[model samples]
Target: MNLETHEPVAENLGVLEIAALLRELTAALLDIADFDEALTRLVTVAQRTVPGVTWCGFTALRAGEPAGVAASDPRLAELDDLGHGAESPAMSAVHRREMVLSTDLAAEERWPDWTARACALGVRSVVAAPVDIDDHVIGALNLYADAPDALTARRQLTAMLLAEHAGLLLAGVRGREQRTALTNEIDETLLQEGVIGQAIGVIMTQRGCPAPEALQVLRSAALALSIPLREVAERLVVTVSRSRGA
Candidate 1:
């Protein structure tokens, strides 16, 4: 297959060839453990596999705002930044939930400023495919080419396939990160509760009071000192331990 031209290599790719390509993509991305690394790998793979793709980038929503997450080259990230406006092809794909293509930046009228800047960076043609990470998170896979009419139907199809795979992999990575964060939070909460329980027990023994009364005394001390309940409990436990050691 001619990797530089927009012409279709064949009427349709053979089933075996499609499967092989998919296998290659899966192998390349499956072992990635970090979300940012996975996004970086995705753009790298797109640049490697897509025809006429001089540079590639991935942009996604971060903390409710769109940001450039990864790029095959640093320049591509700069191009992505220019693509945040309403007329930008990348943001258009994300907003329209479809593919957006610009055959020639010189002739492009919708995004004059963006095209001017992209042309200055040697990008003449571009394609952007929406990557749906989840119901809530949508991203764009942007492909840039140095020549006009570089992104044909066949090339766009390849870009879309890569974007679909990226969505799945990124979603899995994000899910794992969220789960790990939740598990850590739970563990910290349990540990704090245990410390507080121990502190309450100490107060109960020293004051000859029930658990509720001991807890109230601990709260009163925390309020008076203007410290957190957890800090108060930790200090009391440490003080008691040191006294016993002495």
Candidate 2:
């Protein structure tokens, strides 16, 4: 965490610039870090004010995985298979160093792992715009939708308008160690670790399955539903509670 932790940098705001709201968002992006509080704030504004955006989120390339950098939508469950390649469109964009537009996840047909997961979670389409600096792609802005055609040519025009601002912000904010520290909480914070370890033990004892098998069951349900494993855990706990009338 040696890098700057999203302290404010801009002060002069009296003069109103002549540009669209999205353009202004892009301009402000220059001051945000990869995991900065400003980044989350931007998502909030996008969800609240930006048109044609139902869900707004950002993901950064981390050791070839698309890590959830930030998000504004609550429907978006936390992704678990971020580390799995071929299941990550955002990571693929970083590899190709290009943006990806999915007009229809069912019709376009690519990246089964990612698409299947998205479809299971009710994501009909997506637009993944690359976050590049200098020349290398670092991460992506993923806009999910319930329709086939979510973004139009005008939207890209608007997104690119903002991307330029974001690029500068990302380049200035991104660092290996800092990003690592933020992403290192997956195993420890989620799944059979800490609080979850005790829960898994209960499941194993009740279901007569080994700990490994119980864990496998969780992963399988997540894969089947194309949702995060945590969501499955929440459901299991709820189901047991209801059965016991708790």
Candidate 3:
């Protein structure tokens, strides 16, 4: 909830241009119905505003579970081609609970196997920080440039701030999903309960039984039919009502 005061996002560029792009980014994130589209807009804004970053992207994981991102960056169009369960050296760094940087994979030894793959992909340097919330690591934020000097203290700090914002937005999205699921479950339960109550009433009137006896009849029928109690109740209610009408 830290609303960091946004100064003029553009210092050297014209104020109008900066304002327009900032406004565009804000609109895209707020108005876009697709979460992926919103994150794409966010990545675009980060890359355009930040210096020395040839690539910038965010990874989203589900409910603090271990997940991977098919990160979107113009530099690595092939990233989208990676099949499931693929990993990059940069991703391993975030998984290891540390910020990782490789000045040159050709000579670096930190992520030996991962570095070789990255070098083949034309990435000379990479820096990544973990995306986390409430003390749980969800994913990672990664940046890469062809040059070794692509990282700076200012740019790195900005990247961390952006990752924090990503975490908050992700948490909100997950909360909304949970609320929707609960609402659906409640609706289904109400519908089923009404049907079951109607069936119990039919049994009571037809068999001259007490309420608990009627319920037992329904339970027995459900077991015999090998169906849900609610489904059995619905069928019994329909059958009894139809016979009365006839």
Best by lDDT: 1
Q: How far is candidate 1 from the true structure (C-alpha RMSD, Å)?
A: 10.4
- Give stretches of model 3 more than 4 Å off: 1-44, 59-65, 74-98, 134-137, 190-246
lDDT for each residue of candidate 1 in 1-246, tens digit (9 for 90 to 100): 113345555753444645666677677778666677778888887788766789998788764476447889897576676444545777778877888888888999977877887898889999888888876567888999999987776677777777787788878877876786886675455444888989988998999997767877988999999999889999999999999999
User: Clashes in model 2: which pairs?
Assistant: none
Name the Cα RMSD for model 2. 17.2
lDDT of 2 at 237: 76
Candidate 3 lDDT, 136-197, residue by residue in tens: 43766677776775565445555555666665665555455557678667645543478887
CA-lDDT, candidates in order? 0.77, 0.60, 0.61
Give lDDT tens digits, candidate 2, residues 1-246.
011113232331112331556565656555554455655755665555545666777666555445446777655634223554445656555566666677778876668777877787778877666676433335666666777776654554445445555666556555533565665554445444643565566578789987667776777888999998777777777777688895
- Look at candidate 1 and tell me the lDDT of residue 243: 100
Clashes of each: 0, 0, 0
Candidate 3 lDDT at 242 equals: 91
Where does model 2 exceed 4 Å of error?
1-18, 22-34, 62-68, 77-81, 84-86, 133-137, 173-246
| Ten-residue region with minimum lDDT total, candidate 1 | 1-10
